[model samples]
Target: MRRLALPLAACLLLAGCAPTVSLTPAPQATAVGCASLIVGIRGIETIGDAQRRQTDAQGTAAWGTPASVTLYCGVETPEASALPCTTQSGVDWLLSESGDERIATTYGRAPGVQLITTRDASVNDALETLSGAVATSTRGTDRRCLADPGASATPSAIP
Candidate 1:
């Protein structure tokens, strides 16, 4: 019994110290307008225990067993050169590809919000929930991903 007790206590101690996710810190500036935006927003899917610890990243939310979907708030606004924007739920998102993950960011908002999710994950649900939060956070601008003439404004799922 004594031998088992020692191992059991150690396991419990280490379990509490384990980190849920490893997040890469993103570049941040004075995020005065969007600092508190994360609090008002909630996850659309089954993502739980959302947390962000990056120095400049204002906020981050994660979901799934291995964290398939991650959202970062207070990211630096994307440059004009990054094109191919998609409008989802009234917000225009600039899409970028990184390996098997799709990164989407709001086009015109200062201190933009970023979403990093697996290719298989559904960003539409998340964007739906975040649109209002982002709209209220920053001032509007005219920059957007150019839409093809007569093309549907709605963008397909990330894949």
Candidate 2:
């Protein structure tokens, strides 16, 4: 009877320590996935983890193309705790997307990215406008970018 109680307690203890999400496999985000283009991120200004270089490049490549992309980066240090480790811990953390950010504010990663690949003749001349819109919406304080998180995903009028 006592042994059974101990095991149950241990199980409960471990469960409490773990986040609702999985922590294994090191989350190799080859790209940040976001459906809506209006409210999601477009491109990352910079990333923290060097390992994500491939993924980052893949995201950047989507520019003016027909693909949406997201990139995340952060410091996952050994000598400290998780995201609570502060923004300037000088360590690499796990970066993810703003897709979940809209729902939960705690799903913080190092620096997650979100982008949409849609058709728009404006993509050629108004690249900054699009990129800025997404960025300001997700990470910035601008709501114009947040108006329709999935708006840019509309089919390209180019054809």
Question: In terms of lDDT, which candidate is strongest?
Answer: 1
lDDT of 2 by residue, 40-152 (tens): 43343222211111222222222211222222222121322232111111111122223322100112322233222222322222233333333332232211211233432
lDDT per residue, candidate 1, 35-137, as tens digits?
6565556434353233322222346666654566777766777567535577765577877678988777888877678877775566665566567777776
Q: For residue 18, give model 1's deviation from the true position in Å.
A: 8.6
Using alpha carbons, what is the TM-score of model 2? 0.17
lDDT at 11, model 1? 86
Q: Which regions of candidate 1 fall more than 4 Å away from where they truly are?
A: 1-19, 42-58, 149-157
> Model 2: residues >4 Å from true position, as ranges?
1-123, 140-159
| Per-model tally of clashing residue pairs | 0, 24
**Using Cα atoms with residue i matched to residue i, what is each candidate's TM-score against the true structure?**
0.68, 0.17
